[model samples]
Target: MEKIFYYFLIDVPRAMTIWAVLMVLAAAATVGLIMRPRHSGTGTADLAAEPGGPGPDGATPVGAEPALRAEEQRRRALASRALELHRYAEEVTVAAERSAVTAQRRRDEWLTAQEEAESAWQAYEAADVAARRVAAAAVLPEPRTPRTPAEYADRERYLHRAAMAACTRKELSVLQLSDALAHRNGWDPRRHPVEQEIVLRRTVRDSLFAAHRAATERERAAWRDAEVAAEAARSLREEAFAATAKAEEFRRWLPSSPSAGSTDGTAGGANGRVRPAVRWRAARAG
Candidate 1:
């Protein structure tokens, strides 16, 4: 048993020495990995010497930082310009909206004004039509004439008579009659003497004729009324005479005799005219 233990101890020391040697190798590998630079596919010495690599002089080449800074500044300026353009677009959009709103308002106001004007025009047209209708219905006035000494008295007399006649008759308009007389007389008496004289004579003649016709019509109406009254009176007289004749004939033809054995005997007159007793009683009572 002691010999077996001694051999086992000697084997344990040998195993421990091998384990220590492997630990030392692992620590050396770890240190070498930490010191080595990471590389994709290039050699370490080539990567370090390259101008674009991370060496003291290669990290910042001549004019590299200044070029990058200038590029950064340009990018910043472009971004600022883009921001300003966006702001201007917003303002333009706002201004355009306001302008559009104002234009629309103006258009609406104009349309409203046009509508009002149209309404007013329609009203004016209606009024004008009404005025025209009135003018058409009314009698037109006569033109006035200048008076001359030669025809003034005759003209005055004619006018006075016409006015008086027009006043008497409701059918004739005074304005119309006066206007007609004035037109006939002529406005320029000196220039149109013959025409004025002729017109005046014609007007007088017309007035006289009208008056005569009116008088004749009145006389005719009176005659017709008288004829109708006479006819009616003749008819009444004829009816009265016929009634009287009928009454006399009836009195003469009435039977006066009662039949035999009647208590009330009919009386016979001396001339053979028979009278009934009832009729005699009635006459006496009356």
Candidate 2:
């Protein structure tokens, strides 16, 4: 019984050791078989087993060339798209610059025109003032009796005819009066007819002089009226042009931005003077 017990302890342990070793060997062999590269017509296992090496069939992996080509095409497409975007961006930037320059030039032209118009307006005003001064210096003539519109309409013709008649009649009357005065001076104290003829000729001459003075005054008044009317018309025309130019300047120079309205007066002129809209008053003046 003692020998049997000793044998069971030693031999059993030794046998168990040998079995464990064999099991380990079998597991290692199974792992090697499972992990080993298998030669195939497709050669997928060779490529999987050996990195950066030839396949078992000695040909490159299937579909690898197509994948590389596809990748190349993708890279080229990306590059092309990037180039197109760059060109588009550059074109947009150039266009924006050109637009800005055009807008600036337009603004300058408009501003110059406005200044010129303003100067013209001032000159017209000065002319009008001078005309008014001249008008005031002359006394406007009035007629002894108010004439009809038709008679006044042909006033120049009437004045010419009337002055001619007055001069001719006065010359005849003076010649007769000179003869009567010479004859009267010879025998005036004895005869009453000589004195009466002298008094009548003197009264006729005074009447002729009064008529001439009235016609001359009327002519001067007509000239003054014409000058005043002409000056007023010129002033109105200049004022209208100035207002219209100012309006056009604002429309052209203002920027196309959200803040453009606020920047109008501030950014418009050298002196920051804002141009007002063309009011109806300008049209009325015209």
Candidate 3:
């Protein structure tokens, strides 16, 4: 009985210790697996495992990290391209809108210039006609004769007064009257004032014609500038549209990127700065 008791105490304890040690070893192994560190960049330890041994399928873990890294790099490149194209689209759109606005403003200015030119020509024509009528009266002789240059001044002044009496208050400006009467086309001291008026009529007619020519030239230049500006705006609009489409395509190809066409909250947050679809429509319209 004592031997039996000794066997149970010693032998049983020894057997329990052996089983406990085995269980402890298994638990320690499990803890080590749970606590293993992984690379932060790749979020994996496949490279570390490759040197130690092959996987359960009898293949090294070498193929995992490289393919994953390559895919990751490709996605990064797509993201960069999409961002760049979005900015380019925005720049081109702004330039196109500005050109359009400028073209409109120039067109309005051209119209105003055209109207002013027409009015100036009409006024000039009327002045010329009036001066010519007065000059044709030269067929009649001067009512008075002057013997000296000093005497001609008073006599010419008196004759000019008679001519002024026939015109309305605003028919001729004071400055215009002075310039017209200042020159003599061909006159003896006794020549009629009507003959001297011929020079005035010709001067007025030439001035009017010059103004009309200038106005015509301005209208032509304005039209040319407007055409150039319109063309530039159209070209930029097309470019912006193409860029926007290209960027959208890149975004679609990205695996993790939000959908540019999606109206969902997640997509909206991700695509906040770059609304490629909206811009594409706007550019097309422009």
Please give each candidate's TM-score: 0.32, 0.31, 0.58
Could you say which candidate leads in lDDT? 3
Q: Clash pairs of candidate 1?
A: 142-179
Q: Give model 1's TM-score versus the native structure.
A: 0.32
* Poorly placed runs, candidate 1 (over 4 Å): 1-53, 56-62, 140-286
Residue pairs with backbone atoms closer than 3 Å in model 3 (clashes): none
Evaluate residue 118 in candidate 2 and report its C-alpha lDDT on the 0 to 100 scale. Answer: 55
Q: How close is candidate 3 to the true structure, as a TM-score?
A: 0.58
Q: Which structure among the candidates has the greatest TM-score?
A: 3
**Backbone clash pairs in model 2 (N, Cα, C under 3 Å; residues 3+ apart or in different chains), count:** 0
The TM-score-based order of candidates, best leading, equals 3, 1, 2
Clashes of 1: 1
Off by over 4 Å in 3: 1-60, 148-151, 155-192, 257-286
Question: Which residue pairs clash in candidate 2?
Answer: none
Clashing residue pair totals per candidate (backbone < 3 A): 1, 0, 0
Report the lDDT tens digits of candidate 1 across residue range 200-242.
3444445444544555555555555555554544554454444
Q: What is the lDDT, from 0 to 100, of the residue 174 in candidate 1?
A: 65
